[model samples]
Target: MTFANVGTLGTKPGKRDEVVAILTRRNPQLESAGCLLYEVGTNDDEPDTVFVAELWTSAEAHQASLSLDTVREAIAEAMPLLSGQMGGDRFTVAGSPLRG
Candidate 1:
């Protein structure tokens, strides 16, 4: 089953852009780690928040990706820029027309 994760990260007042930058940086390891889709976005009305959507081969793959050195480093870099506020949804995708 495809594991999907969609979330929002609230950044310190004006740090949304920085967080987005960190999240969007190219990480080929993600593909090797089983990431199928990874997107970072923002809402104009939410100036301090960054949104992310990700699809992985499985829930375990998603969790394991966090242990990648580059991923860990990115998290370390973005942590201080965040406000510690986060929200998200995770689910096992039943099917997708795009996949077929």
Candidate 2:
């Protein structure tokens, strides 16, 4: 089944843009695997938050991404810019209008 991951990456008071930049730069690497859709977003009301939405071919694919060299490198580079805790949810894809 397809897997969906959605989360917020919190940064320091003024580090959201920097974090987004890093994630943006690493977008291709993140999507180079079984990823179907990968999106990064931020809220103006929540300047310290960066949101990521990912769709993988399967849960295994998502799990395997953790071991990917590019992902590891992205994490290492983005760690210092992180201030608050990282949190996310994983879901099984049922249906979605965008998928059509």
Whose TM-score is greatest here? 1
Q: Model 1: per-residue lDDT, tens digit, 1-100? A: 9999999999999899999999999999999999999999999999999999999999999999999999999999999999999999999999988767
Find the candidate with the highest lDDT and give its number: 1
What's the lDDT for candidate 1? 0.96
| Candidate 2 Cα misplacement greater than 4 A, ranges | 26-29
Model 1 — which ten-residue stretch has the worst lDDT?
91-100
* Residue range 1-100, candidate 2, lDDT tens digits: 7899999998988989988887877456556679988888999999989999989999998899899887888889889999867899999999889756
Candidate 1 regions exceeding 4 Å error are none
Q: How do the predictions measure up, each by TM-score?
A: 0.97, 0.88
Clashes of 2: 0
